[model samples]
Target: MKKNIWLDGLRSVARMGETAVVAAKAGIKYATEKPSNAKLMRETFESLGSTYIKLGQFIASTPSLFPREYVEEFQGCLDQTPSLPFSYVEEVLASEFAGRDLTEIFASIEEKPLASASIAQVHAAKLVSGEDVVIKVQKPGVETILYTDLNVLHWATKILEKAVPKVKFASLADIVEEIKTRMVREVDFIEEAKNLEDFREYLQLTNNQAATAPRVYHQYSTRRVLTMQRLYGVPLTDFEIVKQYSKDPSQVLITAMNTWFGSLMMCNSFHADLHAGNLMLLEDGRVGFIDFGIVGQLNPEVWSACIAFMDSLQKTDYQAMAENMLKMGATSKQIDTQVLAQDIERLFSGVLMADPQELLASKPSDLNDIMMDMVAVGERHGIRFPRDFALLFKQMLYFDRFMRVLAPYTDIYADQRLQMQMDPSLLLKH
Candidate 1:
C-alpha cells in the first residue's frame, strides 16, 4: 500500500505538471491573439481538446451560468474530430477482449466510422450471429486526459477562491464539480447502456409503442465499449424526409414530445441532450431515441412541482406558475408571488403562444432568449434553478421548436394528447 500510494503521488504531480504546460501554451496564445475574449477562450478550449470542448458545450447549453457572449460563441464548439485509424480501434478491442478472437465476435466491422466525436467513434458492424449493430469505441487516453484536465481545473478553482476576493471564478467551483459528474458519466459506457435499458423497460411497462431506443448488447458491452442495435432513420429535423415516412409529420413530432415527457415521470432518467441528430423518425413510424449519454434526474421537489408548473402553464395561470417555479427551485428569502407572476406574464404571454408562421419565420433561435429571460427572472427572485431544470427546460424548448416547424398551430402544453403530468398517480399506474 505504501508503494502504491507513492506511485500515485508521483503520477499526480506529473499530471499537474502536464496541465501547467498546456495552460502556459494557452496563455501565450491569449497574449498574442486579438480575438474577443469569448472567441479566444473557445479557440483555446478547442486547441486543448476533449475536456475543454465538452466544457465549451456545457457553457453553450447552460447559458444561465456564463456571460451572453461566451454562451453564444461556445454554441459553435464542434466536436467532429478526425477518426482514429482502424488499427487503433483493433488495439482497443483486443485489449478489451484479451483472449477472444474478434473475428468470432463480429463478422464484419466497417473500417470507416459513421460518426466520430471527441470521446468515442461509432462504426457500423455485423455480429457473427447476423445481428446488425453499431459499436461505440472510446478513444485511447480519453479518460486519462479528462481526469488530468479536470483535476487542474478543480485545483485552479480552489486556488482562485483563496487568491481572489469574490471573483466570478470563486463562484464557479460548482461548474467544475458539475462538469466532473457529467464527464465521468459520459466516459462510462456501462452507465449509458443502463440508461438505454431502463428506458426500454419504461416503454414496456407503459405499453407505449410510438417511441423506442436502441437495444443494448450487454454481452459485447464494457466500461469503454458499447454495442447497440443499429437504428436506421432520418433525423426528425428533416421535415421533408420525415413526411415521406409518416403520413402526418406533426403527429410524429407530437408522439416524440409526449413519449419524452412521459419518460420524465415514469423512467429513471430523461434524455437530456437536445439535438436534431439524436432524435429520428424511423421508417416504420417509430420515433427512435438515440445516444443515451447525458440523462437528467429531477429531485422530488422539482418533480412534483414541475408537473404542477406545466399544468398551470397550460391553464395560463401565471400565479400558479410563479408559485410552482419557486417550489421547483430554492431560495433563502421570500418572493412576492404577484410580482413574479407579472414578470412571467410579461415573458411568456405571447412569446410561447406566438402564431405558428411567425415562429417558423424567425431568423434566430429564440430558445436562447427565452432561457436567458427565464434565468434572469430566477436571478431576480433569488430562486436558484437546479441544473436539471435547465436541462429539462432546454429539452422543452427544443420540442417547442419542433412543434413550430413540424406541428405549428398546436400548443403542445395545451394539447390534450400531451401527457403533461398533472397527475403523478398516472405515472405510478404505468
Candidate 2:
C-alpha cells in the first residue's frame, strides 16, 4: 500500500521538531561541560545515542579521513546499548513483515537476544519448517532517527566548511555524505543479506570448503529483518575451544587466510571486519565468518597495485615496492620516486630485523604499528592512502594474530600450503 502523503508530511514536521529538541539538549550539555574539541565531540556523540555512536565508530575506523587525535579518541566508541524489550522486537517484525503473523514463519523466537549492538539485535529462532536459524532485527525507529541525525550533521559540516574555508579538513560535506551512505547501508538488512549470498557464491565458485559464511534465508528476510542459518562455534580467539575442534589449529587458521585471500579477487567485496568476534571455528571444523554489516571493495587499478605490491614484497624489490605504493594511492604533488625508494628501503631493513614472534604477536597493535610506520613513510612524501587500504591492512594484522595463536613457528609467506592468491600475470614476479 502506498503511504499517505499527508501523514508523511505530518511525521516529517514532528521529526524535525524532535531533532531540534535533542540537538538543543546536547548543545546545552556541551556548553556546560566545555571540553576539548575532540574529547567533547566524542562525549557528545556518546550521550546522543545509537546514530551518533555509529558516527563515532566511523571516525575511529577511517583513520585516513580523520585527524589522528580524533581517530584515537573515538577508538573507545564501543556499542553496548541495552537490548530493546522483546515487545519492540515483535512490533518491528510485525511492521516489517506487513502484518504477516510471525507464528506462520517462526516456530519459536527466543525472547533473549544472542547479541545486542547499536543498530540491531540477534535472537536464536527456529523456522516453522524446522530449520534452526538466527533472526537479526533492526531496531524500530532507527531509520527515522538516523535520517534526522545525519541531516543535522550534514548541515553542520557545510556550515563549518564555509566558516573556515582555509582549514585543511578535507571536504567536510563529502566526508559526511560518505558517512551517510555507509550508515544508511548498515541499516538495510536486505543489502547485508545480499552480501551473505554473494560471499557464499564466491566460496562455491572457488571450491572452498574450509571457510563459510552463514547462508541467508531471504524468504523470511526483509529490509529491516534478516534470518540466517545458525552457526554453532567458538570464536577464533578462544584458542582452547578451537584446539578441540582441530588438532592443528594453525592449518585451520591458514585455511581461513587462504580462503579470504581468494575472496579479495573472487568476490564482490572482502569482509572488512574479520576480527576475533567475527571469525569462528565451528564444530564441523570449518571457519565461520559472521556479520556482513561491513565490507570493502577496491577498484581494479588499486587491486592490481595490491597484487603487484605483494609480489614485489615477496621478491624484496624496493623500487617495485615504491612504485606499487604510488599506484595504490592518490596524491596531488610531485614525488621523487628515488627518495621514496630509499626511505622504504631503510624502513624495510627494520622490518627484516623484526622477530617472527613479534611480527606474529597476539597483540594486533604491534602489527598495526608496523603498518602505520609504512603508511607514515608514504605520507611524509605526500602520498596518502584510502580507507580501503587501511581495511586491507587491518585484516592482515588479524591474520598475523591468528598465526601467533595457532602456528607460532610457521613462516606464513614461505609456506607452500598457503595460497596467497594474486593475479596470474603478477605471479611471474614471484
lDDT of 1 by residue, 1-430 (tens): 6975675666667766765677787778778976688988888788777899999988887766788889889978988889999998888898788899999999999999999999999999999999999999999777877887898888888888888877864577888999999999999999999999988998887777988999998999999999999999988776778889999888888788778877888878889985787898888999999999889887656877888876676677889989998998889998999999999888886676644234323434576676677777877899888778877876876776677668766655556776655256656575
Model 1 poorest ten-residue lDDT run: 354-363
Model 2: residues >4 Å from true position, as ranges? 1-37, 307-316, 332-334, 346-363, 380-382, 422-430
Tens digits of per-residue lDDT for model 2 on 1-430?
A: 3464555556557766865776687678678977677887787677667789988977776766677778778868877679999999998888878868889999999999999988899999999999999999998767777887788888888889888998677488888888889889989989898888888987776667888989898889989999999999987776788889999888888888888887776667788878887899988999999999888876656877877877776566879989999999889998888899899878866775643233443356655556666787888899888878887876787787777778777777667888766455532332
Clashes of 1: 0
Q: Clash pairs of candidate 1?
A: none
The lDDT of each candidate is: 0.82, 0.81
